[model samples]
Target: MTATAPDQDIALAGILRAQHGVISWRQARRRLTGSAVNHRVVSGRWQRVHLGVYLAYPGQVTRIQRWWIASLAVGNGRPALLAGLTALRLHGLRLPEAAEPVHLLLPAHRTDRDPPPGVVVHRTRRLSRADARLDMSPPCTTAARSMVDAAQWAFDDTTAVSIVAATFQQRLVVLDQVRTVLGTSRRLRRRPVIESAVADAGGGSESAYEIEFLRLCRLAGLPRPSRQSVRRDRSGRRRYRDVYFDPWRVQVEIDGSQHMETRGWYADMRSGNEIAISGVRLLRFPGWAVRHRPGEVIADVRAALEAAGWHGPSLSAGSGSATASHDGRVPHRTRPILPG
Candidate 1:
């Protein structure tokens, strides 16, 4: 049956909308002729985003648009999955910092070719259909695969572990899934570090903040504190603290921006009041302290623990520690915080 031009336009619009305003030349050719495609490009109605991909709109290109173009540029015979930090970001996993290079994973059979500008193509022989998600817009790698890939591609161990921790804390992907993906990836760098970070997440460390706090404790020679410890308030309501030194009757609360929200703030206040009434010394540290200023965080925590009847050995906050350096740059330890 012959279709009217208007019907074809509508069909094209649907395709464009489905692919986030980007389409492949082959897909466009199914409904548009070479001359018609060239005419649209010349008229500025469509812009060539990649060698064989076009932007259906003239407006500013978007992240999703670039992703679609990268995926489609691989051609039909092979699949190119948006991968690494890019895929993890799309899956709602926030990174410690901005990532770049618009990573794409192409099947090994696709060959190692130069990717379009601003795009980095990775050829992987291990990528299977199960590892890729075809349902997502711009079809990217699955969350587990993307996370593993992101961690492997990360420049540092902290960034890599943070990716694992953030994804697990957000419940975007489970530990078993990450393990499965890691198991399949035999030669991933920093494998032990990734495994340890995943184990920390499994142990109830909700975020990278909690993991850093634990590391600080270990490096400072402080007694290991129970994590996500449950304590009952005066009203019998149970509350969980991020880390608790039961012997010293001390509880450490790791506060992030989420705690600043009205509801979170009030809830924290209530928890703090209850813990205070229960005669427990509470120490609160901003999440940033644990991440960026670990040396200071350890010093403060050490003082707080000592003040809370912890007669343990004095901690040596020296340089080359696992947590952080105690160089002159770090602020000196302040007086121990008293019970509130």
Candidate 2:
């Protein structure tokens, strides 16, 4: 019935600006002309996230949600892109899991500034241009920067693999981009372990699984395999391999149910059969073998190598079924697959 107060509009806009959506009654009244404690108390619309922060949900807070929060938190707009686990997640990289203390970036001068609760701000005088590549998203880092950062900054193998896996999962990133970013990353010198990890990077079977497999091979100390290889036999027939060991004339296939496609299954078989005639030994392993049962898989590989005249040490055994000397999750259904 009353003409409503003016401060109420200003208060609402301020609340929206912060992205917290929820505002304290006292603060609302102080900032907004028409805002009143009684108004919010009477209205059932506000949802509380903390003592002061409110969120509108059933509607979720995405990166946009965080950006809105960041923008309002520091309206001046300094040089910060969400860094650490936050950036890694935004880039869709697979990490061991995730860490707390949402990371942030602020300029060098602000490095020592006290930040709002629940955010960790990293200070950098200069951020890599690559970090600004994907404007279409947010103030997030480029895919390659994200991957490089993950490889260098991740807590462990699981974390690094997850980040790289996530990077590839979001097909927006190309291999060339990853190579370009890594080629000049300053963090490169700080992370030698990461170099070995990236050396084996490959594409195919788009998921965290393959990334973990790459990490596993690195852990097992196996030679890095060539990705998406193409070779021809005497008849000029082309063959494709997920991974190729050119030195050993061997091809390792990491198969998941996805690869066993109705059409792909037959096509792969036809191509594989042809490659067999060219004197290349074909070795296929299931996704599970690389994951839960890597030891057995590793041993089987060593044995296969020995059989192929690889003068390496005897292999260790755990989940291998190829030799019938060990128990396996999926009994080794693969054949010796001798070369032609």
Candidate 3:
């Protein structure tokens, strides 16, 4: 039987009205009954988000859903973070159509008698000061830690690279921060490769692959090229390139998985035609070479530049992996163009 309004349960009405008539049954039960309050929940008046979680308002896009989950998880002795894809959404990294399953992380010692419903909880062993980060809300692992974690379990390399590049471009973390986090966790395997690339990839850098490719080129002693160089052609519009060797009139274009999309392909074709006819030697490098085999990438780049009438020493005194190993920071030193 429905627990109809009792003779003098005005407290329930007061609390409900106080919450703008949008309190949940769980909250109502806590205040009304000494042990457990009983009531029938209305369908339109109260929509069930999860099994026991309800939203009282008719059609409110409530931010309270996440908080409600957090409160419940915290009660279980594990202050959970609305992490992974969920955190990415909150940080405005993922677009609307790209939304995925919400990922949560909690300590292994959650004391709840039963696990929280509607959440996939990963029990992490520890969260360090570096790892612990604050973004849109509660403390979660910093973007660098999250990126390293994601890079390991990503369904695809493209996804991992995208997230990592974004974290760096957004200024959430840097190469050194990632390195330190990796050193502390010892969980991420490819820290050396990714951290090394972060230095070259700065703001406006398209992808992690692009960053690493540029880094390898720099270390290989190629003249540091201008990033995203824009020049107007006869059409009187802007044409951008990944890297531009101005004196050599060569433009290197790094294409990743995303560029394989229909629109990207179309744009690439158009830009390629335009730049090609403009007398710019267009060199394209696939993402795999940039991420995995940088030595090979450097070799190909040197070849392309040389073919583009660039006559320079194949091996420079400063050209080697040992150059970046000295100190992993983006060099602000003036890049002098060699005599062509």
Candidate 4:
């Protein structure tokens, strides 16, 4: 049957709209003649992004478009879901802006001899229907699975730990979901580190700095402090202390880069004054000190605890609390600061 020019244009627009302005060569061939497709490319109406993928529009490619391009370029009639850090970003995890390649996951048996530029291909035998969010546009691994894969695929142990912690801290996925994913994948790389990060995250260490502080406390054999514990100020407003030694009436606040700003500095000073007036000792450490000058941080924290009458490491400090679970399991103290 012969179709009118308007009909063809309408069909092409529909395909582009559904796929974020990306069309595979096969898709284009179905609706366009060979010459027609070539002419569009020659005229700059369509741009070739990958081997057989085309960007139907002319401007710079958006993130969503990049997802579609990666999916179509390597999918080839099989699953090519976004995984790892790429999927985590789509699920609302805040990450630094960098030229990171799109990470795509395919079945273990599928192989692409020539992967597209700016795209990283990963093949896995463990993928299942349950691991994918099929309803999402340019289908991706579920948040939990994506986080697990991200941690496994990270460049180093530190980066891997940060990925897991940030995922939980940002509330991209709940602890249960991550645990479930981890249970299903037994052979994942960096499993131990990932589990440790999860435990810390569940214990209310909401940032990398807080996680490091917890490790330092353990290294120095200090009593574990309850994290993100709630307390009322003079005005009766509830505040979440970063780390609190409840038995000794001491608090430790880890200040990230944000605390260096004018507003943050003023707010922190006000909070410190309030803590002092309440007769509880307060210790503050910049984020860099926790990472770089661990010895100094440990000394100051120990001094504060000793002055507050902490005789030695005592289980009573946080024995049954979120911070100190005897079985190495974290209590349900983590609450999402941001909506997932």
Each candidate structure's count of clashing pairs: 0, 16, 0, 0
lDDT of 3 by residue, 83-118 (tens): 565555455554336534446666667544444445
Error of 3 at 223 (Å): 4.9
The best-first sequence of candidates by TM-score reads 4, 1, 3, 2
lDDT to native, each model: 0.77, 0.55, 0.59, 0.82
- List candidate 2 stretches off by more than 4 Å: 1-63, 74-80, 88-101, 111-118, 128-130, 174-176, 179-190, 202-224, 230-240, 246-249, 255-280, 286-296, 309-340
lDDT per residue (tens digit) for residues 1-340 in model 1: 9778898889988988888888888888878889999999999989987777789889888878777777777644133688988888888776555547888887777763446778788778798878988888877899999988888888897788788888888888876777778778877777766776776776778877887677567656678788887877777777788998888888899998989899999988888887888888888888887777777777777788878767665434454334345451233232221111
Candidate 4 global TM-score: 0.85
Poorest 10 consecutive residues by lDDT, candidate 4: 331-340
Q: In model 2, which range of ten residues has the least summed lDDT?
A: 331-340
Off by over 4 Å in 4: 1-12, 33-35, 77-79, 313-340
Q: What tens digits encode model 2's per-residue C-alpha lDDT throughout 1-340?
A: 5335565576567555554453433345455444444454447455443333344443566555655344234323232466655666666544455336556665567542334566655555556565663353335566566667655566675556555555665564666677677566564533544443444343453445555455455445466566767776667877567766678877778787766788978977877787687787887777766767766776676666666776642335643322322443223232211111
Index of the highest-TM-score prediction: 4
* TM per candidate: 0.76, 0.55, 0.59, 0.85
Residue 59, model 1: Cα distance from true site in angstroms: 1.3
Q: Which residue pairs in model 4 clash with each other?
A: none
Better candidate number, 3 or 4, judged by lDDT:
4
